[model samples]
Target chain A: MKFKAFLTDNGVSLLEKRFLPALDKMGRICHLYLTKDHAFFLHNLLNGDGVQSIAQFRKESLFEDYRISSQNDDRIAFTIDLGLLHRALRSSVSVCGHVTTATNRLQVKLVKKLTHNSQQPMPFLTFESKGYKSAVIQDVPISKPLSRVDVVELQSAIDMAQDLPQTLVQGPDLHQLQSFVDRLKHVGDLLHITITQYGDLHLQLLNTLTTLGVEFRKLPVVGVQAHVPSGDQNMTAQSRTKYAVEKGEALSVQVSLKHFAKSLQCHLTKPDCAFYGITPLASCLTVIFQFFIPGTRQTDKSISLHCRLPVLDPGSA
Target chain B: MSSSEADPDIPDLVCQLDNVQGMVDALSSVRWKRHQDSVLELSEHGIVVIVEESGCLQAKVYLKKELFVSYEYRAEGRPRFGVSLGVFVDCLNTFSVSGRSSSIEICYPGPDMQLLLKSVDTPDACIYAEIRTKVPDTISWDYNFEPAGSTPLSFTVKSAALKEAIDDLEWPGSSIQIVLQPDPPCVQFRGEGHGDLQIDFMYYANTDLLIAFQCDRLVSYRYKYKFLRATTSNMPGSVIKDNRGSKLTIGRGGMLKVQHLVSVARPSTQHPHIDSAAYQQPSRIAYIEFFVKPEVDEEPVNDA
Candidate 1:
């Protein structure tokens, strides 16, 4: 297996300052999955507990002169410490001043290191930056690459997690939501999230003594439209109209408040907006963080981040 | 819909407050401990929250009906309940957005007799909370606080300065002696322990600092330094920011009463509709009083 890439200036900044730091808040260690066209940072995919987060970036958006060769369809997946990776990137940028410039070059390569005391060599992701006066090189250790069967299972988990809920509603402002959730954290251990077809999102915390709730109304819907059968369009439309006259029935799921607050830390990335999705009877709630062009509403497809927060059992709360 | 509208089960009390921070400030002043329980009493005229500590210190926060934008009380008699002071204050803190003001509607006896609070002004979002309240037991002590004589010994000082003076005396002693002299028309705070520290507030020295003064004779009483510190330590920021004055009165039986006024009015611009007709009217205020019993053994000095 061989993998080498030169990071662009923008890529270094985005990874060092935004993406990696955000992932670091989610978990201590994460799997770095590299393929021909994309790279993914995944947390808690194999673990049955805790929140799972996936951050994806298009290869071209972050790397130049990228090359990879492996027996498993040119794909490489290995676990690494998020903090170490972030520190390495930060040191490289600070040391080289203007990385990727004519005189300063930054390259990331996967190599094996031989230690005097050990017979077997250990794999390391090395950051090598050269400047006019000084050169900085940092080595971050990595777990052994996953076997083919393990890679297939990991890919399946990713696909399953990517499944979208039937209904998705935009979330409230990050600052407001953060403050609200923080208050809820003090009141209860579990949070109940309710979403409706009419663009309302309700968050509630309950205890023996008090029940606290917050509702965001008329939020824009971004997912699938309410299902209406084509054959019985007229009758269904009439019935739907009647149902609309009544209050919209809401779908709710209970999740740990601690896990929910941890996922909200993605606000540090300063995403344009966040969307929430909950599938009925599902064991997790989906949160997708969308980044947009600086001044426009158009989404920046180059990067994406989403999290799956495990829902507590209905009887648990 | 207004609570006045006829319904099968009308709530015992419903009130709307425009400035949540003002209410938060009033309640937080008496929240000296993390798990203190406060008794909430509702009357047609206003609401009173009473907190006491081991029968030595008692605080009362009076939020009159005028302080609310709307008040509806239909209960036949006064209803009282007990709630955790810290939880209630922390919950109210969430309703207050820093830059903008939001009105909150408070309702009592929520189906389960819980206190219900809902944010009313925001069109896009609403925050609702229900805090469980217990049936209150009879209060520990009720000091009638009758005046010592025809002219009560009382003085008003700038809250900021008073807070500073009390805080500065922390290191000097465990007990503070307060003396009011009619001859010089000044109040003296004396702390004695490892060292002695005396702070004098002369009535005529600085009108801005010492706003009011009244004394009949030389009356001095010593109080626990910790109890006196509680009164000034948590004086809300708005009181200091608005340059309000706090009145310290020595009632009969060596009882100390500290009175503070907190404005409960949101900016007129935020409630133009309500303030349009009577914009010149002064904003309503909430009254907070802390009653502390003086040290038992030290007889107060009285010059007849």
Candidate 2:
């Protein structure tokens, strides 16, 4: 197996300042999946507990000269401590001022190091940056590459987690939602999320002594037609409205407040907007963060992050 | 069941206040514990919240009817209920958006006797909460504080300075000794334990720091430092920012009463359209009082 890549200035900033730090908040260790076309940072994908986060970036978006070769179809996957990775990235870029114009270039490669005390070799992801005045190198230890069977299982888990809900509604401002959730933390442990086809989102926190709720109305709906099952002519915009009028019921799911709050940390990336969706059977709540171009409403497809928050049993709530 | 279905003769108690932050500030001042319960008493005049700690420390927050934008009380008599102070304060905090003042409507005895709160403004979005209230148990102890002496031994000091002094003295001892001298017209707080700390406030040195001094004889009493710290620990920032005066009066039997004023004025910036004349009408304020008992074995040192 062989992997080497040179990070662009934009990629350095996004990974060092935004993506890695955000992932660090979610979990201690995250699987870094490298394929021919994309790189993914996945957290708790195989585990049944905790919030599962998948952040995908197109290879060209971050790396200029990317090369990878492996027996398992050129796909490499390994888990690394997110904190160590983030710290390495921060040190590499910060040593050189003005990343855009400085004579600093960061190159990352996978290598095995032989220690004097141990006979076996240990794998490490090394980051080497050469600045005008000094050169900084950081070595982050990583787990051994996954076997072929493990890689297949991981791919299936990623596919299963990518399933979108039938309905998706835009969420409120993240800062406002954050504060509201912080207050709810004082009240209860479980949060009931309700989303309707009519662009209404309601969050409720119920306890033995108090029932607190906040409702946002008239949010813009997204990906309604695409997610609806085929052979349904009523899935059009007008027909959807009519159907909503007929069935005024909404999709509601109960989730742990701690998990929900953990997922909201994605707001640190400063996404232009976010869309929320819940599975019909209350399996999970999906939060998709969308970034927009600086001067336009066009979506920035270079980077994307989505979280699947496991729903708690309604009866237990 | 809606209030309409209830007896029309006895209307439900509903009050609306535009200054949600002011109310939050006053309520949070007395929130010393995370799970403390506060009893609420509502009448035509206003709302009174009483919180007590171990029968040794008691606090009362008086939110007058004038502090709110509208007060509609039709209950025949005062109704009392118990609620968790932490939950109540947090619920009110949600209605107060930073830099923007919002009006909140409060109603009592929801179909199930739940206290209901709803944000009045914000058409697109609305925040609502319902808190369950239990029948209030009769207050454990009600100490009627009478002046300890003829001259009504009391001293008023800057709330910020007083809060700072008490906070600084927390590390020295478990009990704090408060001494007032009539000769030099000064008050001193001394803490003794592993070390000693004494903070003095003289009336003549800086009148602003020691706002008022009225005493005919020297009196000294010792109080639990924990209870004394509770009086100023949770004081809201607005109170300290306003530089309000906190008065500490010694009542009969060494009972110490600490009083603080919290302004519940509707920030004029939020309501630019409202005339200044209405804003100048002596901004309504909330009165908070804390009563702490002196150490049992300590005798008052009287130097007349």
Candidate 3:
């Protein structure tokens, strides 16, 4: 029974780029769920600001070489301190490393470059010795993996979160979005975001003292058009045009500015992105953010990050 | 002020600040967290800006006539305008964002005039903002401020020390109990939350921390910690601000006024040797007065 995983530069880069932010959104506490096929990370955000996020990557897509015996049936999972993981990655000189799972500990092998030269400063020696690279392995202890019931619940939640209907605000380019966020930065944490039937997305901020709102009217959107909520109508049909508020009334959700700002951060990474469908659940408002960055070669980076913003009032519906 | 340009409207007046940017920056530093709008009063004696917080607090930042290079106003009586502080600050900081320090000229045409701000550096575009001229509710700038009976207790402490005392308080605290005494262990701060936090600072008549300490009677007053925080958070932080520190003056009527000292940076021009490394840029003394009214129901615990 042989099991070894070679982490490539691409895998490390993916973690550096995407998974790290996901960790931040999830309040630096998340589970690294790994299988033979791919790696899945998930976390339920804390604070009244309900945000849940999951990042998944196919093993073959990110890793250059990964070998696992068919005899192992159970998927390896561990609760990782995201901040500590980031620190370890940063401290590792090579950044790229391999991970081989053991019974109780997860082994991480980071290739660190050690420079050996004359301890003297020589002006003539423009070219020094090519640094010697050595692999330094650090084994991190694994925490308790999720039980069967927890895994089932996590899967169903992810499934229910998939294909959510949302109305994306249109017209304003990335620059406008950045300015809008910057302008509203001083306002309190609770951001009241509203979408009307006429395709106006209004970001409002209010506290016990003052109220301020900015409206983005006739925003561009995907193919889905705003539809009215029919009396005694199909729930599925209503969800299709998720952005639609009641007639002459706006459907508004108060979300944590910090979490919402994290999703908007996606716009910074990729200019062409959409704030997708929103599903207001009992506990959180599930918002899907889809990013499509043009790839250099064959496969482009297209990923959907789901952020569950906690509903201030569960009885509002 | 340059006596250069011409515009319409009678009783028109204009002025340029020595460091116009200084005036702009001073006006912008006003953190009136309570209200979205503040009243800006313009007279021949410069501009007086006032903002109220949570109804209980009123703040005034006075940019006097002396600060300007040429102050002139021909308008009948002192014309006042209510302006959104955030928007006004945004307009003032536009040139700063463009990486150019600007020379500003403020123009007032008449009572019903829109405030016009022209930048010499960015001559291509100037900001013209509508002055909310006739809002009566926004004109609560003047407060009697006279002590009712007793000589109001006064003390001066380093902004850094006061900041530390405030920070030492545990969260969820509602009231800040300030104990001022004339005897030993002169001043003490008490904050009540889940538990009580007490910080005692010995008072000296003249020191870096305590510039002035005058408490004729031992008086203790409790103020809303939140209101105090709203003002202290925007204080001229001890680091960047000049030597003059913050002063706390508690009135007999329980008006807790904290004057945070601010040194407005002025561009160097008086010195001939621009190349001199030690030629320090001039700084004008300014202060933001945060007057927080105490809870009417709470009685002062007098140790007199």
DockQ of all models, two decimals each? 0.44, 0.49, 0.03
Q: Compared with the true structure, what per-residue lDDT tens digits does model 1 show for residues B109-130?
A: 7766778898888856878888
Candidate 1 per-residue C-alpha lDDT over A166-239 given as tens digits, one digit per residue, 9 for 90 to 100: 77899989888987888777677888777766666777787876777787867888765454323422232223
Candidate 2, Cα interface RMSD: 4.2
Native contacts kept (model 1): 0.65
As for DockQ, the candidate ahead, 1 or 2, is 2
As a whole number from 0 to 100, the lDDT of residue B52 in candidate 3 is 75
lDDT by residue (B1-304, candidate 2, tens digit) is: 2224347434468999988988999999999878999898888899999999988899999999988889998776677789999999989888888767788999987767888898878755778899989977776636688889677889999999999999999889698989988889999999998799999999999799999998888788888899999999999998999888999999887889999999888886756677244344554789999999888763445444
Docking class of 3: incorrect
The C-alpha stretches of model 1 lying farther than 4 A from their native spots are A70-73, A97-99, A112-123, A141-153, A222-249, A293-296, A315-317, B1-8, B183-185, B192-197, B202-208, B268-282, B298-304
Q: How well does candidate 3 score on lDDT at residue A115?
A: 30
From the highest lDDT down, the ranking of the candidates is 2, 1, 3
lDDT of each: 0.83, 0.84, 0.55
Model 3, which residues run further than 4 Å from truth?
A1-3, A45-49, A67-74, A92-133, A170-186, A197-199, A226-250, A262-277, A280-287, A293-302, A314-317, B1-24, B27-47, B51-59, B62-304
Q: What fraction of the reference interface contacts is present in each model, in order?
A: 0.65, 0.76, 0.00
**Model 2 misplaced stretches (Cα beyond 4 Å):** A95-104, A223-248, A314-317, B1-11, B273-281, B298-304
